[model samples]
Target: MSLLTTKEIMEIIPHRQPMLLIDTIEELEPGKRGVGKKCVSYNEPYFAGHFPGEPVMPGVLTIEALAQVGAVVILSCPQFKGKTAYFAAINNARFKQKILPGDVVMLEVEMIKQKGPIGIGKATATVDGKVAVSAELTFAIG
Candidate 1:
């Protein structure tokens, strides 16, 4: 079972359908780390134009999914309750492989540093034991 479902995640983060890419959080530690999953679907709207014949999950969306998980880690903390974590920067982003429909992407983010509302996290997206994307994300809570 999931540690947090999409419904519960909705309460923690201010994201709605289409924009809310994280499907379930398997593990979470407030202000520390989070592991989540997103199952890509062929019917996704982006697929309609991303490529008609060969649809692929956009790299930016994958990164957004990672950030959403990171938001969960940040917003779940009692001290940060009701706050929104805005994407301040994305560094060292690398997309290794294409994510296709029907693939379940494993999203993980670990808080590396934090001071007040500014923080950074090491994030990664993987599929079937292989790394698909990795990045360092910076956020400012508001």
Candidate 2:
């Protein structure tokens, strides 16, 4: 069972369908950490033109998914309730492998630093234990 479903996540964050990349949040620590999951599908809209014959999930989307999970961590706080977590910056992002359809992306993000409304999180997305992408994400809670 999921710790938080898509409906529950929507209550915390503003993301909706076509943009809500995470299907389930398997684990979470209100304001410190979160582990989410995204099951990539062949029917994803991006697969149409991301490549004609070869469909690959966009790297930027992968980063966005990570950020969304991070948002859940921050936005779940009572102080941050009804707030939106905006991407302040992305640092040291590395795409290690191509994420394809039928792959399940395991998303993990840990809040490492925070000051006032700004914070940073170390995020990683993996598939079958292999790192697909990782980055240091900065966010501002509004």
* TM-score for candidate 2: 0.99
Each prediction's Cα lDDT score? 0.96, 0.97
* Global local distance difference test of model 2: 0.97
Backbone collision tally, model 2: 0
Off by over 4 Å in 1: none
lDDT of 2 by residue, 27-55 (tens): 99988999999999999999999987999
Candidate 2 local Cα displacement, residue 125, angstroms: 0.2
- True lDDT of residue 72, candidate 2: 97
Per-residue accuracy of model 1 over 1-142 as CA lDDT, tens digit each: 9999999999999999879999999999889999999999998989999989999999999999999999999988898999999999999999999999999999999999999999899999999989999999998999
* Pairs in clash, predicted candidate 2: none
For each candidate in turn, the TM-score is 0.99, 0.99
Any runs in candidate 2 off by more than 4 Å, and if so which?
none
